[model samples]
Target chain A: MMRWTLKSLGTQIASTLASAGGVAGAFLFVLFLEAVFLGESKQIVAYIEHMEPDIWVMQHGVSNMHMASSFVWDWKLDAVVEMDGVEKVTSILYVNTMVRAGDRDWFTYVVGLVEGDKRAGPWAMKSGSASPGPGEIVIPALFAESSGAGLGSSVSVADKKFTVVGLSLGTFSMANSVAFVSFGDLVNILSAGGTVSYGLVDLEPGSDAAAMARRIEAEVEKVSALPHPEFVRNDFNMAMRMGVDVVAFMRVIGSALAVAIIAFTALVQVSRRRRELAIAKALGVTNRSIYFSVVLQTVLITTAGYAVALALALGVAPMISLFVPEVTLLVSTGSLLRMGAVALVVAVIAAMVPAYMVNQVDPLTAFQG
Target chain B: MASSKLIRADGVSKHFGTGHTQVRAVDGVSLKIGYGELVLIMGPSGSGKTTLLSMLGGLLRPTQGRIEVAGTEITVMKEAELPDVRARLVGFVFQSFNLMEALTVEENILFPAQLIPGGIAAARPRARELIERLNLRERRDSLPKTLSGGEKQRVAIARALINEPPLILADEPTGNLDSRTGQEVMMILFDITRDENRSVVLVTHDPRVEEIADRILWLEDGKLRDRKSEDHSWVRDPVCGMRIDEWTAVHTWERSDSKYVFCSARCKERFVEAPDQYVNA
Candidate 1:
């Protein structure tokens, strides 16, 4: 019965195409928005999110990494490292600036990492080296791709030229392309004498990150201490609350329009085939059977639409990533599962009115008409 | 065929509305259809032929009356029970050949049988046999849109018999077909009544149906008009010449303690004013 009903409706290619388009379009729009949110959240703190820091110390009011600037006096690192829970401490500086490469200027975040300390520094490298020596910089692969910077290329920062010596992997930024500079060069550029961005403290074995963070907060004044995970979460929440919710609003609008399109298509299909349903009822076909057939057809349509939308998203994701290399359109299994559930619920809801209409169809109408 | 009543309707009246707008589509109708009887209900449009058929088939409940189909009192049966009754006992063929446009000829015939328990298993073989018997083998997979009017009607007949229903209800089964095709369809129905010993109650406006009917039942203004009064089941009024049902007659006269019903109060008054003139005439 489902096959027959679908085939009957399938003959009207124009309407079926329109319906499929509506379903697929809705799915794709929601997916795009979801991907953008994922991208924004991931890129908000890409530099420090996956660092080996157990406790992250920042200025008292700072919650996000890239959006706000936080600084601590140089002596705070000495106090934090001396805490009993601390294993090692690395002081870092976040310098948001623009770098000029020949005719093009790229907005970039230059992170200053402590010399000889791998913690809170670029650990993964695509080429050259993860650490940048004096008068050298480690550019992120996304920044290199976007700004046409390569190994040994000279990029001018504050009218001073520095050679890109390494390329880091997957350390892209939403606000700007990211690069790593040495502590000496960073101090020279920012004129730092007694100020640092924050201190990343690694906890000793079996030491709790939260406990160490509490210890640091107690000893350090004018600074806030948070566990690394909490810091990452704060960054994500800050990003969402600031502006990324617009994507969520777009998703809701897309879903409503999608529901309308699917509902209209289903209503039109059921209405057109009402005579056929009445005929089936007269032939001893139960109302449940008719309703089941309609619902089944709708599920099939929605599943097909989801499949098409997924294919389109997968096809477009890489291209989108290439265009905006700083942030990636993240597609994961969890997101796909969420999307599948929404599509199924939409399909079922859209079918309800049509199913009830089929149930109310009088069998006698078939004979009389 | 042994004579046995397959359908019994007692004082059935089906009214559509309330107050002055009430339309009595089938009023005070009593009918008994025997097995192997091909009863054709003939009436003009809006004469309640279809309405009466709908009531008998349990598709519509009567406003007042009792209907027993194959010994089951369908009138008092719950609405939920009607589908099973319709599936197991009553098979319907329609005026438009109402075959499901989505399904093919074979699926159409197999549908009624599939409604019963373990029906698909039984219906498969029955469908094959009926398809071959009805000469629809070549069109088994052809949709209703692809079949001719005669072919469609034949498929409908095959469907009606697929469940081996004891009673079949057809409403203008050949109204859309040509006269010769209509006759062929009627003959198929006649053959089912004769060979399978099934009862058929058909509603049609076509005069050609008269040839196939074992007994022609007439309906007008929602009331049954018997063609023959030999059994005195329906009495013809002396003045109006209209058949009056004794169970539902509102106007009647008593002569020597023998009751006689009149078609209307005006007819009853005219008959009482000069009973001898009309009774003798």
Candidate 2:
């Protein structure tokens, strides 16, 4: 039987892997951008959802927590507790601002609540407690290290100084660190009295959280309430939506880059076999049949590149977090698949130019001495 | 169309461009070849030898008139249908020993079998037979690049015969080989023609091959003519006394407005180093 493929099986595999290396470079660039851009939302959503509150009530007209602020009077908590399905209500003062520690400043999401409250406390800690005493603060260990402060060290938030009593993990992201301080201390810092940023509600057994949410919104004059999953989804979408236009624009740019890479590789591969292709054409191999092999090679290259990109992205995230602790990468399955689809599109488009070149090839070229 | 005839061209013409830039590559040429005939098409450079061969083999569509290979009028066939016709009935051999670089001798021989019914597997016995018949049994597993010139041409002939094509169109089949190897390749082609009853249409400028051809068609200025029985203008190299077909000669030098053609680059170089001696001779 005729050997219809590459010189040998090893040559075909080596060619795919070698071409994938070039394709993988393009995948890596786009994946890295996604990690840096959406990394914060990934960490923040994970941190919040881990607390697992039944419902959250923001100040009136606020649908999400990221990049937005809300204020609810402390009396709103009173009104919520009196509702039909009310179990308990807890409050936290939230602010997104830069915290100055010594001479350096780091942007942070500051959460202020009573001591021993887990409703909006650090989900994980490296040292000390989530319940920082009044006049004390809990900062992500990563942020603390960068600020050159650790447990028992002094730090300042919103220009008010507090002793660092706890170091947290899973609270540091690419954009900002989540820092905690006492509710009264935050109130003193903000100089606002008798009001909190948001109210967290827990449902009693057999209570419909969504219905309770609707009731809270209806009874309370100035408030927006949402179920736990809904709140988490909203915050994730909003936080990640910060530079969405850029994300969309980068997606186009990245896709174009991938197309060019694959196209260039396909073109080079086809060009090397000009004589062979012409011979095949003269020998009665239809252009369509030839394209089957070309496209197969391109798709293999693209898929192999995706596998390489996934490995590199996953492998690099932890290394990056280890070396540069401030930056975390979120290589989600959804986005990876999206990029993979883009790779497929790139593979198809890449095959076109070379395939056209093949179509234009004069089979008479085989006769060229 | 006649069943006894393997190829018949009815006033076929191929023009390159329209209007002033037009090149009348083959202008209204007509011919017929019976089965088991070995005909040679010889011409000067740009004489449309390849173009005519391309049309006859269905590798090209004539701009005017018709070409019939076996019983089918190929010129009128749809573009997509021509490839199957060519694969089923026509086999091609080239001067470059156009064996696929990536394919082994046996693999190259069986390359066209993919288009036939039952595919390459069905043609394996024929491939082995051709390999043994062409004296390539030991080299069946060797790639074209690893083979000598004569071996490559033998592989090309074996490949041409693998599909059992009734007509073989060879463009300068022996142009790149030394005289001895060229004669060996020509012998194989003649053997295929006589023994298998296949017709061979070959285009070449090598005058040394004229002795073996059953009939010779001389092409010049885009049309066949009976001006000279000699295939093409033949010139002998002063350095080696080897005759070179001046039309397709790649090793040539122009001095004092006179051209010198050599059979090989070394002879050309020797002449170039001392042009006066050869010119005087």
Candidate 3:
């Protein structure tokens, strides 16, 4: 009969720490990527989606907001507003330009909207003003911090100097920072008078968005209409097609490495304790009991690693703001649960190899002198 | 006086391998060890003493014949059932004092008891008693590696007797101990036989244990030989009137019933001359 205890606690802790560090570190990387992806995806369509618009009327061939430019005469806004199931219409503009703050120049995504329009604006403003007035701009916190431009600081865009009157957090499209500008100022800056990028249409409640988009397409000549959600998905797919899928592939690799680390640790622990297992089996202990003990040991070690990783994720997640201050690293309950489920599954899978090894250990080895 | 037999082996044999490479580790052997008796099987290395003991304890299955341990034909039992038989009826002690390095002295002793029904609660008090009786109370919390050789053997003995099984099998239990410590351990085993009236069977080549054994069974070349030889001297040759060294004798006569070793070829020839006259006489 053999009594089992933590005779090798040091070894167990070392193994657990190694695997936990790997899993938690990979999870943190995945978290940062997720934050960036989410932040960018939201920012790309944030102006359109937050407008509560059911349908969008863009140039006939324009596919997304970032890479494509669609222009309609200012009179189209009034025309789309008169369509059936149409509640209201707003004019919006998109422009990509370089903004100079001191010696640093940043490629920026600019959104121009009508003043006092609640349908489209900086949704979350961490500090400073939300809506920019004429000759004033609201920049995302990430751009302002990175370029050392704060509230009241001036930046030159398109050879025109504008004052930074406000800051918005988590408002960026991929690597391009966002700045809200007045539509009147945008027309003066771009010199494209009486023309807008797209016309946003809000549908009455209970209006079928797909049906309304089709009706709007019929009524508006040389323009295509789409549901706001469908347009965002199209935009996201376009981003994915343009190499954002690499992040997904890296996530898969990170998960596999986490499982591998746990499995390798369990395997080594079982090999080192084979003799102890043999002794336990020889002492009238059933094979199943010995197998269960090995499984339990693996799960305990893996769980310890998971706990350490979880604590690390909590501690390091918030610090991602230091790097990309516009994108807040989200550690939601759903994401934590997902990580835990993955850790448990990896732990179980890792225990299986060692459990099989325990079954093969001969009890007679204990008798060998 | 006739006592009930605790272990009954009828023509049991264990063989390994097949064809020309086959090895008969335990040849056909039949014997009975009675209740409360202490029997020692003495043999040189590779004589199949441990294999026979293992078969009696249900650890290794016999290739031929049947073995009854406490009235159960354990040789015919299924693989899964053997552990239960061993846990309930047989206790084993090894030469290496195989105490678990991770467990404290008391926990090692209580391990077997915990496997039985109502064992968990009963184990604690029983372990405490044994620790006190073995004078191990002070060192009860220490791990195996920290204990001295004698202390380790004492803990092993306590563990073996923890379940209070009817039959105890010890394989060279004192092989690693010094002469004085060896005798002390042997004496303790002998005392166990007397105090509990438990049948104890030990396999050892240590001569110090002979005085404590009620009977000694001899084994050679995987076969059982004569029993209870007081002096390691002459074995009578069935062929001619002669005394020969059983250890060094080369000439031998093998019959269907028994084997006889002879000192000379002349004696073997004489036996072959008239088989019945010498063999049956």
Candidate 4:
């Protein structure tokens, strides 16, 4: 049996590895792109970790806080700050803006962090100072690199210029670079009578986020507060649901291509071994054995292909990160096993018809040619 | 033929297709091949030589006859038991040298052993011995595609012999080879039959094959026409054992008032040594 398996291994290498490598290469690239999208979302969540907010208050009917409108009176923050178990309450005003540095402009998001609120400040600083005063701003390192701007340089946003006091590391949202400034500066730019887009509430230790969220929703309904956490979660869920649509489309396309490739592989393998299969039958090898041999070959080939694809993903992960920062191609052993199981199923599905053809081959035809 | 014959075919018939379109490939053929005999079935194309061989080897179930191989009635055996009978009692050599291209020569030779009941360990030494005897040890590691026509046939022969089957069935075994290589292959096959006390039933369109057979069963139009024993003066063409009629043969030599006929000069030269051995009293 070992000898048979070893011979089968050699047959797989000689016949299927080249084509499998090509297919695996294409699959690796697509998987890498998907990993980048997931990694980007993860990085966005990591960037805002210091806020430590138990509940986020956003506008009603808003789909995503980053891409929707949310405005509440400035007085709402004071009301939230007085709520029991609420350690602190701060408002964040964020909007998309085009920032100009050295005669070139790049699109970015301008986020307003309240002064003296350490919970909402830039999490990591690569250079300069994180303490941006009124009229000063913190820009992401990617923006600094692309714009060729440095410390003390001035960046113009909404026809107003601000000094770049600090450089923040790895702060990006959906591929857009971000800039941070004081809440007062943001209020002045928006010209909205000091109304804020969102209220960030930091809860006391041991407070349940879900419980606080329900209380906050009730309070907001009584006072008609604009931004609510339940609504925010609903909006987050909706936007993520859209992201799921895109993921599903990607999966469909990947699966279709994988099926075609595997089918072609099975076809070629069966055609090549038709004579051998006939001879086997002539020599009293059972139809079941012939079927198994072809199926086994398909399984072995697809498994090797999937393994090569995983290795390619791991090999190119760091290189991909170099081009698209914060994007890491991560495949756990569980993921590998899942992919292998999927490939095996795909292989069997692909090999079924061809294996039947092998079983039907007339042993007497072996005498003809 | 005795009831204990190694192979017995009683009223065997094979038909292809359905109803009006049916073609009788083998029609009502009954014959017996005894133990330790070299029998040749000779016929033209479409004469059911191969069809008969298929039934005799248990590769095909005759549509209407009781066939027995090694005392086991194959017509009554289930499909699952066919492989067991084939592995235990019958070995087949195909005309086209159907060696697995992916496997090495040695691997192809040992394929039958791998398919048998026991592990390949029992067949390894025999395979090695056959390989060395056939002068294929040097090319054992080479793939079938790389070997010459003769070497490929030798590999197929060794594969057929690996299981030590009692009955050897070969269908036009030398049809694809040149005369010289075919002679070498025939010698090896005949040597195997003589040394192992095995029975050989070879089907061929080539008349030369009849010379080496102890008996020749002539098939024509899906039926057996004659079973004739040839005189020893007919030199068995080493390429294929076709018995040439000494009176009308083109290649012939006289010895002791009897003329020995050959299909080719090569066989005549091969028979020159110990001519008395091939001559009838």
Candidate 5:
């Protein structure tokens, strides 16, 4: 029933906030990197993977689509469609190029969709239909805002002009974006009349994708087959590998900042108020009780700080998108939990030095004549 | 009967360090303090008065011999258990008015109740009574920094009595106050002995408190000594070599378990500035 008033409560609150701010800064930095690196890869995989394909057949020696190029002879599709359990084969021409809209340009992965096919095309459209006929294009919904181009606008790819017939959804990220165009236009742009970029194959219901992919690789020449899930994983890793070390280093720096702030605050708390601790000890409060209170306060403050950091990140992302429409901050719960774990670590380490200093307080030294 | 005594010490001695550098701070002093007695332990600066008080209150264990408070042997108890004993059997008041600066007067008064039964909630009525009784009701919501020295000491006294400990140990309770305020505090402490029917042991060099005390224990060179009223002699401060009339000297000062008289504030300040230089010389 005793009301406890800590003189350092204000300092503790400030320190907790500062530490949490450091952690949140780290989280945002990671999100930005993921948006640039992993975020783009995620879009790349989602574009192809969401077509409900069981296997991806690309040119040999090419494993992913984030940075690699792939091509197979047009004759390879005949053999793939003839294989057992081959429900359907949708061939799409994929190329990474810059699309020019008016004066602005963006690095775009242009997926050339075939006529009368839904697979490997924009899954959802903000306007118009999912398919783009020859001389027509469909860009990700956010790209329209970034490029200042919308439906009915003309955009150029590979120096070839095409009308934007539709705006696609779930195909945009800060890293890169996807644009759908007519198959023949891309083939004309590439001037390769007898080749296909990727052959998306769907399997019969209840068929094994990995086994079918293996059968395709063994039976076909100059073409590699990969299970859909494995291809997505490979592409994600390939994209993130460039920024992985930097993201990790930034995380370390952020955690260090949090640790430094919390530790220093606790140190100041004890050094400045040691006599108060001694006075309490003199009045018969046990060392255990005093220490328990110190540690408990630190943990509570650090936890509150982490919550503040999460709110800050979630709150700031949308505000940023207002100015930079193409920028998507991938603030995941997994990353927040990682920082929360770091905050907990900071709280424990911060409490030790002060608690130890408090242990040295002699009540007899508190009296002065 | 032994049961009537609030505190009893048997040949207790406290020594610091060892060999050539060893210092005997409290040298085998034996004493008894009875219930409801206001006992004043007066001594020169280095006479072990604080050390003796520490031992009696269970703040420090005697190096030799044993101490019993409220009939419980404390010197033999383990170091870890001393705090509980001190909290339950003793209340401490210090010269600095060591109140937590952030807590209001009422909260400060109830701070020690955490170690006692019923905690702060149960001690609220008693805390209110103490605040009203000590004339601190007006400053009940004020922090220590906002209160005057007199008020701070009153809050400390109230804090000391919150747990209703049978014994109150005060080390230089008036050392930080002006003479008038010091006298006022001494009167309040004197009242606590009668009003609470408890024992109050105060360590001070203030000659003003001699009349208010039931018994006076004078210590010198870590040992308690007996004196006769006619044995007065003109003395120079051993440290400063300044002659002063014991009755009228304003520079009478306590340091390092010994007391001295200086001719001027300069001498007292010089002595305090660096005692080792003067005492060693």
Candidate 6:
């Protein structure tokens, strides 16, 4: 029986792969896109590690990075630091700056962290040293690679020349590339000598984050205290609002197409095997056995097809990454399990229609000349 | 009395369609086939011989009346239970052979036996025995499509005997074979019935089959007439010496003071030319 099942699986693989190449191609493409865009490569949480702030304080009406605007007075940090349960508070400046490396210039978000604060500065520096002195800068790896500039190289941003002193691991954000700079330097760049963009607050161990946020919001009326949880939620919301969820959409479409392909294949197979099924029924095979065999055949086929697709996807991952530099194909155990579950569901649904046909087959007609 | 008849049908009528358009396929068949009897049902086309066989085999339910095969009234059995009854008591061979093309000869033979109440482990030896008895062991693993007409018919016979059912229902089991092959198949079927004490109800339009039957039933227009019981009423052709029934022969002759008959014109001519020489000299 296993040999027969294997033969059936082989036939199913050949037939489905021959006729429904588009579905398989599309499924692999979706997996490739997921690896590149939404997978570990686009680490939103990792970028936030540089701030190291237990709480963020933005303007009262600010929602996301691009959609909302906020600029609290620089003096607000002093009052925030004196609040009960406040450990320390420092000012952070964020601005979009275009840096020129060689002849080509690209846009990136220059984030300002306080000097001498290891918890809040260039957390994932890959090369060179962190805490770039007054005129030095830390560029993300993607910008450095694209701009063809490395450590000790001079780059210009906003007409201010600075030497590239280090490289960070995480590259671009969903919105833009992030470059770490000193808060004092950013103050000079944004104000030409004035207040910063937002405040970064660290709370004591026993502090209630929500209550602290409310108190901070009440105290600093001009700006709002954005909790860490809300900040993460806003980040995801912004990504969704900007149509950066292409990976998720591709996954859905791939799943639907896989189901359709399996269903159509099962239907065609059942139609072809109608006579054989009828003969089996006439020969006294019970209705239950016929149904079970049809479903078993479908599940066996789908399992084999999914295996082939997964192997092919893994083989082409590097090629996909090379062709589409922005995307990476990360085939983790979790993703494979997800794909297997999807294929199993598709197999069951696909087999149901044909199994129903088998159940309805009249055994008497099988004996007819 | 006669070991309580293996099959008993009472006023079994099967009608197709409705109202004025109703056609009675097996109008009202009431017959009993006892154990170890090979009964041949002979009729012309559209004479309802196949329908009667189907009713006897539990393949079709009679429109009205009871059918008892192997002590179970099939008419009272539910649709779900019909297959079990058929598998346990009746093994059917169709005119078309009805073998699963995808399965091998051995698999087809083992199919019915495996589906019976017991497990396949209990049925495997029986299936092997039947396969060997039918001389199909050499081609057991070969698919039905690769077998010749005669070989396929023999496989079908093996399948019918696999479960060791008390009764065998054959609908033109040799309909597609040549005369020699047909004779060989009939010989095997009759030998099985006589040797194994199994009852057989064979449905056919050909009168040549009447030779092997213990009792010959004549059906005309969905009704059974009386049984024919004349000894030596059918004879082998002198030229080829193949058994031919008197009703279907091109020429038939009867001997004086004896009801015995000879098959063809040539055989009768030869017998008449030298009466004493051919008779008893």
Best by lDDT: 2
Better of 5 and 6 by TM-score: 5
- Expressed between 0 and 1, the share of native interface contacts present in candidate 5 is 0.66
lDDT of 6 at A10: 57
Which docking category, incorrect, acceptable, medium or high, applies to candidate 2? medium
lDDT of 3 by residue, A1-369 (tens): 213634543435666567667666766666556555655555565555565567778888786776667787777767888877789887888788887876778777787878878567778887888878898898877777777889999988898889998988767554566788888889898788988887778788899999988877787787888898888777767654554586677666766776787678767877877777676666688877776666666666656766776776677767865664555454556556866777678777877777778778876676676
Q: Give each model a TM-score.
A: 0.80, 0.89, 0.77, 0.81, 0.79, 0.76
- Candidate 4 local Cα displacement, residue B172, angstroms: 2.1
| Model 5 docking grade | acceptable
**Candidate 5 wrongly placed segments (more than 4 Å):** A1-7, A11-41, A49-64, A68-76, A79-87, A95-112, A115-119, A122-174, A179-195, A202-234, A237-242, B1-4, B17-21, B230-281
Q: In each prediction, how many residue pairs overlap at the backbone (N, C-alpha, C within less than 3 A)?
A: 0, 0, 0, 11, 11, 3
Q: How would you encode candidate 5's per-residue C-alpha lDDT over A1-369 as one tens digit per residue? A: 123524556535565466556555554554455444444556656776677688999999888888678889988987999998999999988888899887878888898888868778888888877889989999887888777888899999988899998898888865668888988988999887889999999889989999999999999998899998888888878767866888778777766666666667667666766787778887787888877767766676667667766776678766766676566556666667777777788788878868777788787766644
Please give the lDDT score at residue A234 for candidate 2. Answer: 92
Question: In model 2, what are the clashing residue pairs, if there are any?
Answer: none
For model 2, residues B1-281, the per-residue Cα lDDT tens digits are: 24667788888889999999999999988888999999988777789999999999888889998888899989889889988988899999988888887778888999999988878989999998988899998998887889998899899888888889999999887777766677788888888888998999998766666777788887877888763645356788777677777765756788888888876555677788998887788
Candidate 5 residue-wise lDDT, B55-152, digit = tens = 89887778898888998898778878888888888988998888887788998898888887888889999999999999998999998889998899
Off by over 4 Å in 3: A1-13, A16-76, A80-88, A95-108, A115-138, A144-174, A181-195, A198-248, A322-327, B1-4, B227-281
**Fnat, one value per model:** 0.58, 0.68, 0.40, 0.57, 0.66, 0.34
**Alpha-carbon RMSD of each model:** 11.1, 3.7, 10.8, 6.6, 6.9, 8.1
Task: State candidate 6's DockQ.
Answer: 0.28
What lDDT would candidate 3 get against the real structure? 0.76
User: Model 3 over residues B1-281: C-alpha lDDT tens digits?
Assistant: 33369999999999999999999999999999988999999776788988999889888889998999888889888988887888788888888888877678988898788678877577788788888878899899998989987799899989988888889999888766654576678888998899989989998756657778899898878899875455465577785455555654445778886878764444667777887998668
Best by TM-score: 2
Candidate 2: list runs displaced more than 4 Å. Answer: A1-19, A116-119, B16-23, B226-281
lDDT of 2 at A181: 90
Task: Rank candidates by DockQ, best first.
Answer: 2, 4, 5, 1, 6, 3
TM-score of candidate 3 versus the correct structure, residues matched by position: 0.77
True contacts kept of 4: 0.57
